[model samples]
Target: MIRFGQLVRVQDGGEYGYAVIGDNQGDYFTENFGAKPAWSPTSKGTVLNPNEVHHRKTVVEDQTITLFIDGQQILSNTMDGLAKGIGAFGFFKDRGMGSVLVDNVKVTKITPERPVDPDNEGVVPVEIKSSDMTVRLDEAFPRVLDYTLTNGKKMQGQPTKIDTIKINNVDIVPEVSLEKVSENSIKYILKAINTENKINADLTILLEVKNNTLEFSVTEIKNNNTSQKTNEEIIRTLEIPNHSLVSVNSSETNANVYGAKISTDTTVNGDTLTEVTDTLRSFNSNYMYAVISNSKLSASMHSNSQYSSGGGANDFVRINPRVKEFESYNSVGLSSSPWIYHRDVMFNEQTLELPEAKVVITEDANDDGVVNWQDGAIAFRDIMYSPVGAESVKDLVAYRIAMNFGSHAQNPFLMTLDGIKKINLHTDTISFTKRLW
Candidate 1:
């Protein structure tokens, strides 16, 4: 009879464990979860005696086992039992000179239905409705949006493996604005509101691999053909701090060419080093993504060195997940460069109306450039993000000017966007000033 892994999965032989009693008594949950009276491994784990009561319950105290064979290769200690392994079962007879028997070793794997620590599982999905829906692009922003998941257990963590954030049967054209961000959480305000009473949507906040990513070309993969696939790219995903104040600063850095780079700071949470690419993919670019993985020791990493080590509590940061990184390979669009600003802007669905103005208007605020509809609309948007104050108007105007014109304008006013509301855009300075009636 032939045997395959699927065969076992379909018809398992049932659970099997190991148990032995004598001067030393122990138990193995299954052939895969083996244990011995006086054995240990170099790996890390704890040994559970399950109590000195030979076969009563699982408990133990100060009893320690420095199991060794031929007075060498100390298998494990009381502090490392979980890793003693599934193979090799034995008993320590008088003075560790007893008849010890090992067993038929089997293999086992555990599949978790849920993820841990801010994984996608914690934040369930929900469908948005019409009546409850709101959108914020220009003047109005959705302050609240709710959804229900498969399970109602109170979960909290970062979302993972999201299908999509949809609406009206069509996938939502994801447009996002600056949501309420705090020291420990970042709530991205979506552009659309959900009023859907039925169905659930796993709302995914799209985080692009910043342009500051360690660049990799198609050639990086061993079997991947590079010359034929010039357009192929590898976007690196960022690992955000578990608990920290996530904020973006627009201040550009000279770190590398390719324009402005976003510096994401999670200071509120204890984070030693920022970007950490465990292994370099050896990209075909001039610049290499720095790999400063472990935050354990004071030794240098990014410059060049082997892996840093240490585990458990009181350490810097844990190693990133296994099977990750290489698996998150995605093609990046050029326009998706990283941008760190005071507030994020989302895609607008409709033309926005200008906010009421306080400045003396002769209703003659025509398109001389500064007093037109376009400028007014721009001014209004600036005001929304402005801090409430008399000088805020000027800052609004300044921001509007900056937002409208390229950063290289000499005369800020002439370069700023003023005439917005009055007309449809034809050029950078075109606005309808004829509505002076």
Candidate 2:
């Protein structure tokens, strides 16, 4: 039997989080801010042996906690609204008539570094220009100061004034510098130092300017405090402010643009009236790509994929894209911003690199000489449904079949068959069976 816990804020009030592995079962439980105890359980009867000694590890980074046994991850939990305070560590055993021996105990603080001086100055504004677009970086922090198109239309206005990168709930105002890699590419280097903790963190943002597109990628994240053996959760935020609308296109049917609404009405004269209203609408979800656009210009941010050490693609590397309304005083009345947020655990020290998240910009995304949600849909299709092999199609079909027929009382197989039949009726030259074959 093994049990270990961290962030033990209060002992007397039962305000802490812990993990337990015993009796062939494992669980990660927590009681935050003296709330009722909650737990996330792993598969029962799959944990420990009766007469065996095994290694156990627990990692607590920000709001995420993970438990590993014998180098295999057992359980992970993300608890929001956690108690704010430095806490202790603990080990426990069930009250039984058995002897337990523990040895070779080790503990390490794996948090990232902090800013050197929160009020340090000497940040110089830098601008990189292409043939059609020019982007200006903030002089005081690591954010976009201005983004202007060739038609002299500013996309980002009223930019964020403070540092948006947060580590361990502390905002990191890193020392900012720029290195011009090429005529059309620049690298923004941000370095932070924590004197008390003796740790340092470096983040690199690579910006490449094409004809009409300005691509931004977070190429590297490095820190001196973590190792390959260490597992820590890293949360990052990407914000594009002052847009008319932000669209999250995860699927064909799950596309929505916040801050704008379309409504149609029929009048007494039998004429249809269409109205597009712009308001503040908040949205959050997983997405393939997120697009932020105004009347004149638009930009889409693609998903960044990261692979793990086990040679499997980690789908949870990017968690959610959130859209919220920002304060704006523009003439077009567009006041929203799209925020592409990421929350994932980094298990190594080798300058964690991420996939390039391409930001494609255009005045007419769909090439239809118009700018609207239809253009956003085109951007979505270009990212989510690009060419793939037959194996991907087979996998998708298998997944859909499983979802429709697995352990459910209502099976929709007949409905799916009917839909396929309808498709076959529409296409006369090529039948559905022939296509599948």
Specify the highest-lDDT model's number.
Answer: 2
Q: How much lDDT does each candidate structure score?
A: 0.21, 0.48
Per-residue lDDT tens digits for candidate 1, residues 1-437, read 00000111111222112222223222122111223122322222123242322111211111222322223322223532222212222222233433323334333333223223223333323322122121111111211111112232111111223323323233443344443332212233344333332222222232111111111111111112223221111111111221100111112111111111122344442222232232211111111111111111010001110111122221222122111122322111011111111111242313221111111001112335332222323322322223355553443322122232355545345333344432234344432222211
Model 2 C-alpha lDDT per residue in residues 336-426, reported as the tens digit of each score: 1223234344433344335344444566765777565456445544444244564445433222231333556253566666656666566
Model 1 spans > 4 angstroms off: 1-95, 100-437
> Lowest lDDT 10-mer window, candidate 1?
1-10
TM-score of 1: 0.18
Q: What CA RMSD would candidate 2 show? A: 16.1
